[model samples]
Target chain A: MTALATGTGGVGSCFISQLTWLSKNLPSTRLSLCYISMIDKALYRPDYAEIDFDTALFTLEATGVEPPPISTIVEYLAAAPHNVILVDNTSAISLAEAYPAFLRRGISIITPNKKAFSGSYQLWQEIFSSATSGGSYFYHESSVGAGLPIISTLKDLVQTGDEITRIEGVFSGTMSHLFNKFAPTSGSGGKWSNIVREAKELGFTEPDPRDDLNGLDVARKLTILGRLAGLPIESPASFPVESLIPAALENVANADEFLRSLSKYDNEMEEKKLAAERSGKVVRFVGSVDMLGKKAKVGLEWVDQTNPIANLKGSDNIISFYTKRYGDMPLSIRGAGAGGPVTAMGVTGDLLKVLCQLR
Target chain B: MTALATGTGGVGSCFISQLTWLSKNLPSTRLSLCYISMIDKALYRPDYAEIDFDTALFTLEATGVEPPPISTIVEYLAAAPHNVILVDNTSAISLAEAYPAFLRRGISIITPNKKAFSGSYQLWQEIFSSATSGGSYFYHESSVGAGLPIISTLKDLVQTGDEITRIEGVFSGTMSHLFNKFAPTSGSGGKWSNIVREAKELGFTEPDPRDDLNGLDVARKLTILGRLAGLPIESPASFPVESLIPAALENVANADEFLRSLSKYDNEMEEKKLAAERSGKVVRFVGSVDMLGKKAKVGLEWVDQTNPIANLKGSDNIISFYTKRYGDMPLSIRGAGAGGPVTAMGVTGDLLKVLCQLR
Candidate 1:
């Protein structure tokens, strides 16, 4: 039995489309989508009847009932006739809090949610230990560098006994897009505030752009990767994260107000960009985990024009793993870091991994 | 039971060290090595006794017997009390030919050996079909990019229902080194022949450097990737490949003779580099499979100076996959594509994958 819980729009809808394709192509697996839900509504049967992936969204919109509590959902899935694999595509904190409870009842999970893994050290310990105690599988490949194989590659390096000395990358697509447009490698770019306003207009940033500028998204990604690379990172707040939001704008009434006033500090950003240009480099926002020093940091840095990070195009994310086996050169992966379809691909990929190991 | 068949030098010894590390850290899995063999000798017991990974190499040197025939070894592994995973680290065509026989007997296989998959299309079909027929597993993540997650990432993108349109890369590390040094992005470089000689002295090229200049290795890798992307590529030789070895020296008696006489034709390569430089581009040897057009080609190409392929350092490889979901920008991976330890890391990573699936 398979369950999908997602928000009504964005990646949730894209995941359902891919699920329809998988069900048709892999009929032998007899994969049945038994339950699906949005934040306020849910669709399922008491007998665990299969739900049609192609019509799941339409059905949920038409005849869905009130959603059950997290505990009730866990009980329903764990009591199914066959094995259960839950696909959590929502970033809801409450749902993330229920992961250990689900795992303790022998329900495997595949998710793209960061909160479940990067929220707190105790929660991280509980999630894995519960999976071990109940012999359940858990995978979150999309928690960092969505759909870029960053998490899995790092896991392989560590599991295969390669000593990873460092891991650094452009972990946030918003930051990447901002920097690439504001400080392109070969050309002078527009002012930083103008770029920020333009990015918001293009729907690249959150409704409240400060959420993206505060560096929490990048920090959450670094926390997930840092722990995976053998560092016991406490949380996203445990390290120094250089926020791009100006101090005066932190308490702005709204995003429009913030964007309107952002130009006042354009000179500061221009100075930083110009300084990097003078040294034959470009400014980029990056997150890094220094394993040897046991430190994780997220911020802006001057990157060589030839470095992969400086050369990143669009909003593509790039992660480089520096390990002993690979010597001086690090293993790196790059691509679109965020998009509804690609983010859902990571969720679907993790689901496939869980399915392969099932029975 | 686990068995390792290696060539006793280079990658074989590195794989042993990695295996030793895995056996210690993952002791809960109880993955015991039961057999080991080089080309000339073998070590094992009738009872499938555990061979200590830490001392297996020394033990084989001290007490080993003449290796048995391939058929006999397959039979012995099939009769073991537990499941078997055979690690093939040699690139011997003969042993690659025996892969189907081993899989048909219910023994899973993991390796970095390219011959097994790239040799013949018929063998490729037989290998997967036999594994399915015998209820066994088979994985070779290192076949395309050593320890870089290239094959796995491509498989994930395809399996999760993403439509792949193109696959392109500088696949060979030797080719990457030669071109990077011969046609640097920023400044004028030395002659192609001089760069080739330097690569050989640095141990970046094969003993006979022509083995790398021939372009067959890159073609083989392209063939494997193309097949995985759902193309029925017949074989590596079925496509066009541009060999760097000049026609006059194609049949040179020895590598030393070829190197001594290579400078005679430097003007031809110089012209190509100069032409590319005029267009603000650099020359790189690249292999590409255009899925939409159903074609795969390997040859020299002009790349933008800022392209990731043009900025590669040392002996590194870069692969880019263009797909429908990713839109105009392709997902790319870059790293050390060939090395003993990294290649062995891929082998060990595949072993871990297979182990997780074992009942």
Candidate 2:
């Protein structure tokens, strides 16, 4: 099978390294990378020859042509004699919206991008339908829980005729760290603002801490999980997501200003923390979906100390899947939910799945 | 693809139900149940027509003929016009030893039986090489940790080029229940003999409680994990496995007789429990594989209360994968590790994977 890839960021670089290892390891499965690209530059041959993975990234950065339009790229891949797989490493919604065009042209996709699946119900429907009509496949395993088997586990449960009653978990590494530091189960933790600031300095949060605080990242993960569970979630914005960004800092001019003003609202978070402690519970930032009620929510919730969500270590993400076959105790997966190699592992694993099918 | 099955016991019955549901839901994939069999009887059409899954078990039990030789069954499956997948749900070592025969004839297999995988190291090598040479696939996700994604998760990490440093977990449901009942974190629990007797009555242990107490079940699971993680483990017996069955009871004639006399040795287990408590730890039955050191062991271990293995609930199994990419924190999975529906879910999930590739 021929492979094409976009993005040269953290996950993208790690994916290239893993793909090189796979090429050397799997003698039976032939993976020919014919196209490699970033946002502005691309590397490919008119005849679609295999590009050497070890040198492709460096050579493309040194001397590459401007990327062509999505339609032209789709047409180029569709004309190949062998099956094609487009590995989308970028989180750009523009590239995600073009998924149907590629899938409709018999080009399969294996991506870690969340936007493609959680963006809109209409696009989700189109992408899936196009894959079926064109006899291609689309998989986004890292969209929700990085390298964790959250998406695949839930999908197997639903596909195998098991009913998923609920899904609850700490879906974000940033929130996992922040809440764990602010309201640890052992005892009262530091003030919320101090924990957030410390997390920011430790590189646990996004470039702007507000990006992690807005609740959209967790909401996007929930949206993906809910959709896979057979819920027609319209968009990430379709549900009621409780944001941690206070109104005072909502319109801050810059991230520095936002961080500085965040302390003023520390009392509000402290009160929520104390209320949970009074009841022998700890507060955690989590996302949950009730399948029977057809509802999904992302926010802070009081969890018992014995609950797996409250017992998470470091910045590890924990997802508990409650299904009919599993009964009361949900099937759960936990680990580092974000990072270059782990996230890239999800894409690489998905590519292997596609390779098996293409064979 | 054509399907053949052996065994119609707990997991086999549930797998058939799931397959029937899959046939109804997956419109694009054609699944024809061409053959069905028990230990002594078989059902297959001369023309290779679809045997309806909804009534396969009933029809097989009522009118099935005596099963022929293993070679005959292999030849029958190999000659099918479509791809053939044989689902083995029996625990018989005799049937497991015949896996190479089927795979050499281009017959794929998806099984929950542990015998084929955790058997002799030479047999493991033969089974894998046959699958490669004959262009067939083999998957057994439920052989260890039921349907908790334990096998698949370890596989993905290794295949994606991650270095697995260690593997530690409670791999048996009976053991998990036993230790959690005897040395629970909250307080001192019941006597060891009483817990075992109660668990057997609850049907959590095997027909003979000694079958689970022997610790070989957990050792078998560890053998599978160590092999997958690149260790050349010879066999489960090659490594030290601390069996809990007493010397006198080891030769007991019956389960009832063993259970009645088990109380006489309660002090031996109580000593271990008290030792763990002295160190502020809990004693749990566990298996560990040290990859670099090339060591694998199964027995009781003192675990910190904060450890995921110690914190496991009910009969839930917890597997922690210590890998290079994952760094200090290991990728972990926990859930109900034993049950008919969940175990069959793993088999059904592997079948879907085969279907995708066969497409």
Candidate 3:
């Protein structure tokens, strides 16, 4: 199978490493690196040569050509002698939109990009239909909870005719970290502003912390899950998403200005925390897709001390599927939801599954 | 593709129901149940023909012929024109021993039978090698944790080149229930004898509750996991297992006699629970595979309140995977580990994955 990779950032770099490992271990399947791209630059040959795993990135940086248009890349991959898998790790809206174009030409996709799945519902439909029409496949396990097995498990439940009544969890590692330190279940937590800043310094938050605080990331995840649960979710914006960005800072010129003014709103978050504590609960930034109710939401909720959601540690994500088959106690999965190696593991895992079918 | 099934017990009956639902919904895959069998009776046709899932169990009990030997069954399946998936939901040691024979004939197997996987190391190796040699497939997701994603998750971690350091969990639903009631983290619990009795009545334990108390069930689960994590686990008996069955009760005639004599050992368990309570911890039956140390064991452990194992509720099973990529926080999965519906869901889920390969 021919392989194409996009982006050379955190997850992309880790995926390349894992792909290298997989290529070595999987002797039955030969995965040749036929094409690779990073924003403006790309590396490929008309003959689809295998790239050296150790020096591919450095060589691409040194001697790569300017990347062609999305359609051109699709044409190249579609014409490959063997089946192709396009691994997209970047958060580029343009690239996410081009999924249908590539998939329609028989280029399978394995991605961690949430935008392709959680964007407008039309795009979601188109991507899948294109894969079907083209006799290709796509999997986005890392799109939701990174490497937490959330997507695959949900798919199994739904595919096996299990009625998923409710789906709930923390969907963002940054939000999980912020709220965990801000309103801990046991100890008295620090101020919300300080917690967010600490998460940023530790690289848990996006480059612009507001991007994490806006609740869009969590909303996007809920959209993907809600749709998978049989809800025709129009888009992430169609439902209520309680953004953490204070009104005054919502239009801040930059992340620095937003961070500097975030402390002024600490009193607001503190009040919510204290209110929850008075009722013997902790406030957590959580997302839920009510399949029975046909609703989806992402925001803060008062979680009981005994609830698994309240006891979550670090930046771990916990997802619970309340299916009819599973009964009262939901099937829950928890772990470090996001990381270079872990997210890449999800992509690699999906690749392995795809290889089984395509091989 | 053609399908065959064995066993018509709890999981088997439930599997038929799910398979019925799946066949109606999966328009692309025509899964024809060519044959099905229980221990005493069998149903099939010389030429592979689809059986009605709704009436299969009832029909088998009414007019089924006596089951042929394992080799004969394999020979019949191997002669079938189409690819075959053999769904074995039985605990028959004889059937477990025949996995290699079936796989070597290009007959794929999807099962929840722990005996097939956690048996002798040679059998484990043989089953896999036979699958490769015959170009067949097999998956045993329900072996460890019912419908939980334990096996699939571990495979992803290992296959993606993540170094798994340790795996620790409460593997048995019966044990989880017994300990959660007898030594709950935040509650004053009942006597071990009474807890065991309650669990038995609640359908949490095997018919012979002593079967659960013997700890071999948990040992078998640990063996499967240990081997998957790259250990050459000789067998479940190769590890040190702490059985809950008292020395005197070990020779009890039946479940009733065992339960009547169980109260005699209440003090033994009380002491262990008290010892844990003295340290502000709870004692729970648990299993662990230390990959780096190359050791595996199953026994009772004093767990701190913060540990997920201590706070487990009902019959939920929790597994934590500590891997090099995941770092300090282990990837953990928790939920209903056993039940007719859930266990069958695992088998059905595995069948779906195997279908992807075999189709």
Candidate 4:
């Protein structure tokens, strides 16, 4: 099968690199690039220098292709003799809206986009029904957790008589970083602020760290997870996000300013850490959805040291699905929750899953 | 899809129970018992009494027209209008020999039997070729690590850019039981006799505990794993079997006699355990295949307590596949290595995977 993949950012570059390598290695599958779009093309020229394959077949544009204006790409797909699978590596909101069109053309969409499912319940139902009716698959294994295979595991468990009662996890790399860096552990008061700065420098956090520090990114992931567990979840905005930045620091102009302002809140967090340590507990930012009692709001919780999430280090995201069959000890999945390579691998895995399902 | 499953003893009974319950609750798939063979039919009858499913189609005879022989089973499959995927849950080694014949008749085989792949390299090659030639699949995901999905993960990792350098794990549940129960703990002498007896009584170990304790069971699993990682491995018998029991214990006439003679070697193991602890390590009966210097040997390794396998508890097995792409921390798969239910679920998962591939 010939693939025409787009996007040229971090995820985009990783996908293209994998596809290019797979094209040479996998004899059965053939991949070809149809388009490459990014804010800057000069930066990626060195990365594409080794490619001996045809580049003229696709154009490298400066801006991303508009979702509604993908008719030309769709035409290229329809013209091909072999079946084509459309991979959406773009923003979630855009991909979600464009998914139905691809499904109409018998093109499967495998994405890391969390938006479509985490959107309104109507959109979620529409995407699923359209994909099923069109004899195609919509796979987003990378949406909730990166490269851990949580969705597939859950699917297998549910299909084989295991009933999941609660789905809980440290669903964010950003939050994991915050706790790992800031938590009191024989470190100075200013150590937390310095680590956050280093994280931003390493490109681990968003350009504006507020998107991560405010807990919006984690909330989106939790929303996606709840839907996968058969819950019609509310939007991420609806979840009560406990901000790491104090109200005084919220008005910072940028990441550097934000980091400088976060120092004031460190003492307050240290006190909480001390209290938790005295009680023989470690703090972890956790997201949980409990179905055993009355259907409740799925949101983040502060887990104790005894909890699996509390033990998670670095950027590791750990998920524990408590089920009737599994009893007290839930089926746990732990691994690198966020990274360019790992997240891209998650997307790649989801793409393969769709390809495997295609007849 | 409607499935007509045959047989109901040992692992077959577990599969039937799982399939029956899943089909009823989740009505996405329907299961019908086409045939059932049992030494004592009373066990299954009373257990299934409360379930109001039709049993008129089922048969009771152990070896009769009810459950047809291999040839007749293939014929029934060829004549059936709906696409039938043959799942062989029997221990008949001849089923491996007949796999090619079934594939030629357009029937896919999903079996937990290891005989086909582990018998001979040439025969294993022929079986694989025949399946591909006949445009069918022969998936045995449960053949290696029960419900752990080790084979599938290895396949995926190898399919990507990962070059497996070493494959290590506790591949035998019976061995895990022996090690956990008998391997000397803090200040206690090893209870070798009691561990062996308890393992047999609980059905965790094979009828012959020697097969597990002597490392033959682990060798078979490691051989399968080596093959999956693209290694041309020798048969299980070729690997050196390190017996936990002394030479004198091997000549014992009965289980009681063997138990009586186990105390002599208890002191030796206790000393070894203490020595390992002093060196900042734990003694785990580990099976590993390392290809560091153009030579590979599947043998025992004493891993440190910090290692994943060393921390494995109970019958839980943890596998680590070290590869170039994965770096130092290889992809780790940990779960219940042995159990009728988990093993049966592995077969069920393979069935679903094959179905997905077919679609």
Pairs that collide in candidate 2 are none
Winner on lDDT between 1 and 2 is 2
RMSD in order of candidates:
1.3, 1.3, 1.1, 5.2
Backbone clash count, each prediction separately: 0, 0, 0, 1
Error of 1 at B80 (Å): 0.9
- Residue-level lDDT of model 1, residues A238-305, one tens digit each, is 99999998999999899999999999999999999999899999999989999999999999999998
Quote the TM-score that chain A achieves in each candidate: 0.98, 0.98, 0.98, 0.85
Cα lDDT tens digits, model 3, B235-329, are: 99998999888898889789999999989888888999999999999999999999999999999999998899998898999999999999989
Shift in Å, residue A214, candidate 3? 0.8
Query: Per-residue CA lDDT of candidate 2, range A208-245, in tens?
Result: 99899999999999998998899999999999999899
Instruction: Report how far residue A38 has shifted in candidate 2, in Å.
Output: 1.9
| lDDT, each prediction | 0.89, 0.89, 0.90, 0.65
Those runs of model 4 whose alpha carbons end farther than 4 Å from true positions after fitting are: A1-5, A30-82, A177-190, A238-241, A294-314, B1-6, B25-58, B61-72, B177-192, B291-300
lDDT of 1 at A144: 84
Fraction of native Cα contacts kept in each candidate?
Answer: 0.86, 0.88, 0.86, 0.18
Model 3 spans > 4 angstroms off: none
Worst 10 residues of 1 chain A by lDDT: A1-10
DockQ of each: 0.87, 0.87, 0.89, 0.33
